[model samples]
Target: MRKPHFELPLHFMLLPPVIIVLIYSYGPILGLVIAFQRYVPAKGISGSEWVGLDQFKYVFSLPDTMNVIMNTLSISVMKLAAGLVVPIAVALMLNEVRKHVFKRLVQTFIYFPYFLSWVLLGGILIDILSPERGVVNAMLGWVGVEPIYFLGDNGWFRYVLVITNEWKEFGFSTIVYLAALTGINPTLYEAAVIDGANRWRQTWHVTLPGIRPIIVLLMTLALGQVLNAGFDQVLNLYSPQVYESGDIIDTMVYRMGLLDAQFSVAAAVGLFKSAISLLLISVAYYLAYRLVHYRIF
Candidate 1:
């Protein structure tokens, strides 16, 4: 048989991204060695003394480590659940809109927030959620309620994280679900309608079933990020006052690695997070494929 020609241009198109990933993503993996070494910048990676798993042990011994881990898990899980539910609900409501122009406008408005950086949103949230002279407090004063410190209070801070994270990201997530909804067969909805199904019934049976694979795919992908409770948002929004509830793995790592100069312990904690995330992602993919026959790739 004759050899077939390879598409050179098509392969060439992928070169830039491939090179970028190799340099930026895969290249930095070499630094993972620091996890096992008592890393010192003055001595450098080569000269840093190898401490084996001592860093890992130290990480486990720290009482704050447990608190940070718990906070990370709690915040991430709540965000994940809210992220899935709120976006799906919003997409469904959008899908129900018969007026195309209005629906598009609404979508544009909602999706606008996703384009804003966490730095910007965090500042805006601080102002809006301020206990004094903020919009929320101003409104509460009307209803004869005391001003509540949403960002500073340990009890309310995690909830604030979840809500703000959802508010910022849900719009983009809704767009994904909306795209999935568009791919659903219109005939299925017609059939359901013919079978005397109402709007809610059609959504529950036909619409949801049609989008099941996408939902499964997203959920499976999200499992890998169960430990990532958003570094930017939390770092920008949280303070020492709410650190008990708001301090996550990333923030803890930042403090240990950058501020406190405990580089090895920080790397160890990071490696632990990566391992857990990998395990969770693997399990999630397996369950999704076995249960729903859904594969993202």
Candidate 2:
């Protein structure tokens, strides 16, 4: 038999994460049986009534089901688009900064919020967007405009979700692109410069091409998250008034499963989401591997 190149300790180092994946990820899959059952807490999985597709039928029969699905898709798609554009733009902008001190300070400021939990930021946003005395509304009031209910009004809630999602996520993504930018061959830019390519032309031709692989990789990976519309952020920020625009599949599931105790219905939704996500993730990973030679062991 051929001997292994990696040391045994390196293999041992992988055990913790593997064990966590098993415990948290695979273990819960056993509970998916309730999706086919009319689940009851007192009766439990084995004892629960097996209703087959009735729960799913009931879910779809509701007036808000399609609305919830549409809301989720719209919000997630907007977030995905913004997530790509904002981060790539910010990274390119920051790359152009001449002063190292100022550049680093700006990076730090933007990246700081990425570390904050949505729970904390939700409270801050609520206060800032408050129509009564919030900073944003106060500024609007100064401009002789009425205070806008960003979180409450259906008209603005989806956009608010997108903006806030970008604010929280763009920094981390920007850092990824910045690292990719560093990996690009400096000779390419030098060659472009020697050819009399101006800054904008150079960026358009050379810079964007250099980062294309990273962009493709990120875009492909993002496909798997098409259904996940910032559950924690939406949960924290949304209200009944904004449900028309802000209610997503995750929030609906939370309401059904936890709040309303419709465990079977929630399970069906979870199963549906998981199935689609698994398919998407598989396709995304395959595309990334083929396109960018990206992979995870």
Candidate 3:
């Protein structure tokens, strides 16, 4: 029997990427040590006094922690739901449309928002949703309705964040489902039609089933981010008035650590976020495996 050829040179080619990934990814984790120390940039991490869980205790004892956690969960979950459903709905609608040129044009327009930075998009949202002389308010005024403080009011702030995030991200998710949609065998639809399966039946059985694995994968990935409730969007769009509803873990960390100089406490909060993320991702992966035998690994 002939032995299989081993590509030794290919193994050497892989070393550079491995070295880069280790440096860029794993190297930063060393900073988590600050979570245990009374971290001060001037003192340096090693010179800093070790406080252990004192920072963590302080973080939990604060009134804002629970509220921020709730806000983070609400906003993240809402975004996740909208993020999942909108793309699925859009993909289904697009699949139903036989007009290729019009479909492509719509797709292009929707996808444009995904590339826009939050800084630019935030300004655009402020202008569009501005209470005074804004486009949405102006239209509402014509209908004899009162202008809404979409950004300033706590009640409306979370909703606006979710909607804006969906507008920005759903297109990207739609592209994923669209790719999955194209992979569905055309013969399945033809076969369904021969069996007198109507458009709804054909879609119910064929399209959704074909895309189910991808949907599960996407949902699992999304579940991993149950804590990240749009730092950039919230930071850009929100003011102090809406902080009650809009404050999230990342923003809280920024405020506590960078702005407030509560470095150790901020580090502890960050450490907690990382731990939760890891736990959630593991649970999600296990659930996905049991439900659909899905494994990104």
Model 1 agreement with the true structure over 87-199: per-residue lDDT tens digits: 99999999999999999999999999999999999889999999997999999999999999999899899999999899889999999999999998899989989999999
User: For each predicted model, how many residue pairs clash, with residues at least 3 apart or on different chains?
Assistant: 0, 0, 0
Pairs of residues clashing in candidate 1: none
Candidate 2 TM-score to native: 0.94
User: Which has the better lDDT: candidate 1, or candidate 2?
Assistant: 2
Tens-place lDDT digits, model 3, residues 148-256? 9999999899999999899998888898999999999999999999999998999899999999998988898779899999889999998889889999999999998
lDDT (10s digit) by residue, model 2, range 1-297: 997687889989999999999999999999999999988889989999998898888889999999999999999999999999999999999999999999999999999999999999999999999999799999988889998999999999999999988998899999999999999899999999999999999899989999999999999999999999999999999999999999999999999999998889999998988898999999999999999999898
Enumerate residue pairs that collide in model 3: none
- Segments of candidate 1 deviating more than 4 angstroms: 1-19, 292-297
Off by over 4 Å in 2: 1-20
Candidates by lDDT, descending order: 2, 1, 3
* Superposed Cα deviation of residue 156, candidate 1 (Å): 0.6
The whole-model lDDT of each prediction reads 0.93, 0.94, 0.92
